[model samples]
Target: MELQPLATFRVELAPVLHVGRTRWGDRRVIGIVGGSFSGPRLNGEVLPGGADWQVVHEDGSASIDTRYTLRTHDGALLYIQTQGVRHGPPEVMARLAAGEDVDPAEYYFRLFIRFETGSPDYAWLGRTLAVGTGRREPNAVVYDAFTLT
Candidate 1:
């Protein structure tokens, strides 16, 4: 199967709420303030209120889990969920944590994305399986998504 370009999205985030260390790991929650997305077939704005519930492991790898809403330009509401991981060399990860604008290629951040919607115009998304390569900016996360076809 070939990977088809799906969309490129930038998710704006608020400051991270560190929940401290737990048995699982260091948990943190970052509010999804706002953002936008565009592609050949989909274009929309990300609604506020969603969040990323993340867990940083002892080895510095982070488990990325996020849920959010997307409003299409045509007025369809869609639910979006992504699960992924982000990791890299210790020094690079440290720089990223320090809020530096390091190149995305320096780290490994990837995601498995899922979409759900009841609108007939976007019904095709329900059956599509997508994957994304992500980058953590100072206050946002950007990713280019691809669907398996």
Candidate 2:
């Protein structure tokens, strides 16, 4: 016998709100707006590939601008509206604002995005977004970075 692949994917819809405090005096929280849809489109077309994420403040402020792209050409995509908050107030962002030295790790972070397929429904992949450890340059104007896979 041989194993077959999935044709479609679906995740139950539900609004989510989560929060947690880090060991280094940092606190994080998030609110999932809604489910997203991604299908075959263009390079910047966040579907049939991936999407973007923005880490914002509690008072409706936006942080670093993080984006996700498709590395492979498969019938896969991601879509969702999410907002987050970070506490403890690191100085890296402040330093970058002032003209001083700041380490990326000083404001490290992470996010887990799991993709699930139908029938034998299971997570196809999981992407984690961590500070300092990424491919592109980190945004200082905002609070933190994001990841997707």
Residue 149, model 1, lDDT: 95
**Per-residue lDDT value at 78 in model 2:** 36
Worst 10 residues of 1 by lDDT: 40-49
**What is the C-alpha local distance difference test score of each model?**
0.96, 0.29
Candidate 2: clashing pairs of residues = 36-79
lDDT of 1 by residue, 1-149 (tens): 99999889999999999999999899999999999999977899999989999999999999999999999999999999999999999999999999999999899999999999999999999999999999999999999999999
- Candidate 2: tens digits of C-alpha lDDT, residues 1-149: 33222111121211212233333322322222222222222111222322233443543223433333322234444332322332224445455334455554555433233332331212333332222222112222222222332
**What TM value does model 2 have?**
0.30
